[model samples]
Target chain A: MKKRCWRILAVVFWLLLWQTAAMAVNQRILLVSPLETLQALFSLLQTAAFYQSVAGSLLRILAGFFAGLVLGVGLAALAKIYMPLREMLFPVMSAVKATPVASFVILALIWIPSKNLSIFMAFLMVLPLIYSNFLEGLNRADAQLLEMAKVFRMSAFNRIRGIYWPAAFPYLLTAMRLSLGMCWKAGIAAEVIAQPKNSIGSALHRAKVFFSTPELFAWTLAIILLSVTLEKCMLHLVNRLGRGLENAR
Target chain B: MRVERLCKAFEGKPVLTDCSFSFPTGETTAVLGPSGRGKTTLVKLMLGLLRPDAGTIDPEGAKTFAAVFQEDRLMEHLSARKNLRLAVSTPDQQISEALTALGLPARDETPVSQYSGGMRRRVAIARAVLADADVLILDEPFKGLDPAAREVAANFILSHCPRAVRILVTHDGAEKSLMQVKNVLDLGMAKEA
Candidate 1:
């Protein structure tokens, strides 16, 4: 705990130096002091608009993430069962993976409303990763166990539960970890470009437009806090789910 | 029952050609053969897990079959008892009795992964035997155990279902004698290298 505190203190010390440098430069357009950023953050926290913006972005992004997870897993399952389906999915997954997030956001803007654009962008960012990882996992399931199940004439359900699920879980978990982060980053970027009403991105955009550097920094800090907290919560949920499965066994 | 004109090929290469045999009822038969000589294939064909390019498998009334694979194909997460229960709906008492006889002391709660190799082998054997089936196919069942453990397993098999049709596949001639195999189907002595 002491070592961790020291490391944190070192980070604070660097931020203080940055604050001093920004003040000495006296250029609010270029850089904002840590004190000003903190003051802006505290001031923003007192307003209902801040909460509304945070909540709006959170709901939309999470919606997209959930949708992607479901669709990706379903497609992966289909891809595993049918060769033609897998072949068909290959090019589509590649397209999604290869395309730039900004390109996707821009293209999506013409098709979807600005309010929903971030959600769609987040879905596009997450889908291919989940699908590819799950497909690879299903493909790499233990052949020996499968053969054994075959010899025993295990039911389809039993084979899936006993063999396929176990093999695919680790890969699925890894994909979830990676995809969640991507979704957040991409979703926020999409929101910033789309400038959706009642969103953190919109507030950030407003701050930038007004040259309120401290407000910008405050909102940026809020984004970082949300990202870190959400990632930790997701990891905790995944670990808890794993433990529950272990206990069920 | 008979396996008549049994022939199988992988890709372009043929493994068993025009192979014929009769597996007698109410008797234990050992299919003794060297590795890669279609012994496992023969077991699979009998179980209908594999198809023969040209052959007929005339199975008797024993449509239901239970098998101990060459590898102990067990659910790593589930306990020995749970694994057995999944395959067969036998009572806990019966499973316990069988497991104890096979020298698995802590039977019910320990997952197969936690068990040692010998213990896992015993669980697999117990699972196969406890399953309500007329035919039992064991593929190299006693590969990893010491002599004493093998004896215990053999005794458990003998006591559990004395009248079932047993097909034991192994490369060891000594295993044939140890299991008191009535008939030996030496696939090695059959035609083709």
Candidate 2:
């Protein structure tokens, strides 16, 4: 409780500082007060446009996140089962890791429509993290437990559920915690470049063009709020799933 | 199971060389050895977890196996009963009963991560004893137990272990009688006074 109070106080302190600096500047185009930002946010929430933009962006980002998760886990499994496939993927994996997100966004824009760019970018950001960590976690399987499982003549499915899941779950959780935030950031960035009609990124672009600093702050706040909320939900699910599986075994 | 001319070495050091033994049905065979005498290597070879440098282990029509490795290999994330329950075809009540017989918590709510060394060893014991298998291999299964507790564990093994051949790797001479072992293979004969 004390920690939560401290966090709230810290947020209030920063907002006060921002408000003071905005008043000092006295230029609406240059700065926006916290009060003005909040007012802008409230007014934006009253519009159908706000909900349409939020829903569209939320759907696009979530689609990308889920797609990345499935492909990441599936590819990790395939790579583990087939070493030749892993070898084939090495160069591409390295390229994805080394290349900047902006480069991929721009490059992808040429190959696919702007509406599809967020999916590609989010998948790009998440794939290597899940792939490498999962492989590492799989490698870290407890030898003693594995030997015990073998002696018991456990079937392959049981072996995975009982032995491997406990070993590999932390990696999965880590990948998710990292990638969910990444997918949103990359997804929004993709939208800014692509200018999809009903998107937070397109709204942000318009706010920039109009010099509506308060509107820009409101949208930025919305992005942060959504990111944190999604993170909490995802991590809660990960922890519960991990404990449930461990207890089930 | 028949182990013939079984040889294994790590790097260049010879652990076991040309060791031959046939485990008989309806009996317990104790392989008595001190540390560094290839006892564990032998157990691993028998369990087919490691490839022997040379030789063979013929199952002799025995289809299934259960074992307690030197390390208490219970899943640390699971409760003691859950670990035992995962390994066998027995009902959950029977699993708890087996744990109870060995003086372990029947419905332990705590994960095995919090278990004492002796408690973990006992859980491993319960898992092996409760498994429905043709053969049992126990490597230093009584390592952390006191003499009194050792007798409880030994008795449980005798009563519950299948009549088919069971192999026990231990250093305790008293265990030979305590477990009512029918045959003893002293791997440390080279060092035994």
Candidate 3:
């Protein structure tokens, strides 16, 4: 309870400082107070178009995240089983990790429709991170346990559930936590560039063009809230899955 | 099972050189040695977890092997019952019986990670015994157990694996008599080249 009080106090302090700064500037177009931002957000919440934008962005980004997750896990398994595949993937993964998100967005924009651009960007952002972390986790599995599995002649399915899953779970969770935030940020950036008709990014773009500083701040706040909420939900789900795997007989 | 002229080395330092022994079926063969005597190397070779620099381990038609390794290699996140189920397709009744015989709580949901050292060791042993393999390898299987628990574990193993070619790897000479091991291969006396 003490910690909660301190946190609330700290947020209020920051908001007051921002309000004072906005008043000093005396220019609403350049800087909006926290109150104005919240008011703008409340107005956005009242609109059907705002809901559509939120839904559209959420669906595309989450779709990309799930797709990246599945592919990353599958590819990591394949790489673990086959050495040549790991060798083949190493350079490609390195390149993907090194490449700029904007370069990909610009290149992808030419090939795909604006509505699909964020999906591709989000997937691209998430894939390498999940792949590397999961592969590292698999590589870190206990050698002694693996030998025990071999001696027992455990089936592949049993080996994965009993041995591999436990080893890789923490790394996968870390990947998910990291990639969730990145995917959202990259997805929004792609949407901003691609100008998808009904997306939070396009809404943000519109707010900026019309000199609606409060609306811009409101949209930015919404993105942060959504990112944090989604990340927490995903991590909780992953932890539950880990528990299920552990309890599986 | 038979090992003929088995040799193994690590980093060019010889651990076992031209060692041979026959492990009789339906009986326990104890491999006795101090640390660094290649007792584990021999066990690994027989289980095909390691390659002998030179060797031919004849299983004598045995297809399946189970082991309680030096480390209790239980999936740490899983309960004792789940660990057993991973290797053995045996029913819950048999699993519970095995756990009970080994002095572990048969229906406990606690993961082996939270168990005491001796409890984890028993889980590893139970997993091996329940596997019902053609060859059962027990590598210091009772390391962490008290004398009474050790006796119970030994008896459980002996009774369950009656038909298996059992190989007991231990430096402790008392284990040979405890497990009723008739054939003894003392690697301490063998020359390491």
Candidate 4:
């Protein structure tokens, strides 16, 4: 409770500072007050177009995230088992990590429709992080425990559930927390560039073009809120799944 | 089970050389030696966790093996019962009885991570005993137990694995008497029992 109060106070202080700055500037195009931003957000909330944009972006980005998660886990497991595959993926994952998001956005636009750009961008941003972290976790599993499993002749499924899952869960969680934020930022950036119809990025681009500073701030705030909420929900589900695996017979 | 001219080395240092032994079924064979005398290396070779530099271990007809390692290798995130469940699908009632007999809390939901060292050791012992393997290898299984708990664990192991080819590796001489072990393979001199 005390921490929450401090957080609220800190936010209010920043808002007051922003309001004072806007008043001193005396130019609506240059800066907007916190009140104006909130008002714009409220107005946006009342429109059906706002809902469609949010829903469309949310579905596409989440589809990309889930697809990346499955492929990342699968690829990591295969890499762990097969040395040639690990060697083959080393340069690919490194290239994905090193390349700038904007460069990928530009290159991808030529090959795919603008409607699918955000999904592709989000998936690309997420895959390498999940793969590397989960593989590291698998590498760190207790060797003694694995030997015990072998001597006991445990089935492959039981060995994975009992040994591998527990070791890899924390790494998987870390990857999810990081990639969730990255995917959102990159996905929205793609949307803005690609100008997908009925997307939050398109709305943000329109707000920018019209010099509607308040609307731009409101959309940015909405994206932050949505990203944080999605991250929290995903982490909760993963933690529950980890607990179930630990206690399973 | 018999080992024929077994030899093992680590980085050109011989740990065991030309060692041979036949472990009888339905009896306890204690592999007694001091520290750094290849007691663990011998067991690991038998469990197929390590490859011998030479010779072979024939299981005869023993199909399955279980072990209590030097460290308590129980899943730290699982309860004692759940750890046993990973090895065998024994019913809950029997699992609880085995845990209770070993002086662990049978119904407790606490993960083994929160257990005491002695409690964790007992959990490891219980896992091996309940694994129902034809060959049971115990490497210092009673390391962390109190005298009373050690006695209980010994009795539980003896009672549970009557027909197994029991191979015990330990430094404590008292465990031999407690488990009523008759066949002794003293590795310090590399001599046959």
Which predicted model would earn the best DockQ? Answer: 3
* Structural similarity to truth (TM-score) of each candidate: 0.91, 0.94, 0.97, 0.96
Looking only at chain B, model 3 earns a TM-score of 0.96
* lDDT for each residue of candidate 3 in B74-181, tens digit (9 for 90 to 100): 888788898888888899999999888888899998988999999999988898888899999999999989999988999899988999999999978778888999
B183 Cα displacement, candidate 3 (Å): 1.6
lDDT of 4 by residue, B1-193 (tens): 9999999999999989888999999999999888887999999999899999999999999988999999998888777777888877678898999999987899998889999999999999988988888999999999989999999999999999999999999888899888889798889877333
Which candidate do you rate higher for lDDT, 2 or 4?
4
Q: Rate the local accuracy (lDDT) of all candidates.
A: 0.86, 0.85, 0.91, 0.91
> Scoring model 3 with DockQ, what do you get?
0.85
| Candidate 3, pairs of clashing residues | none
Q: Candidate 4 at residue A233, lDDT?
A: 96
Estimate, for each residue in A59-105, the C-alpha lDDT of model 2 and write its tens digit: 88888888878887888878878999989988888888899888999
In model 3 chain A, the worst 10-residue window by lDDT is A240-249
RMSD in angstroms between candidate 3 and the native structure over all alpha carbons:
1.5
For the second chain, the TM-scores of the candidates in order are 0.95, 0.93, 0.96, 0.96
Question: Which candidate would rank higher by DockQ, 2 or 3?
Answer: 3
TM-score of 2: 0.94
Candidate 3 ranges beyond 4 A from true positions: A1-6
DockQ of each: 0.47, 0.72, 0.85, 0.81
On TM-score, the stronger of 2 and 4 is 4
Q: Any idea what lDDT model 3 has? A: 0.91
Candidate 1 residue lDDT tens string, A53-75: 99999999999998998899899
Candidate 4 has an fnat equal to 0.83
Return the candidate ranking by TM-score, descending: 3, 4, 2, 1
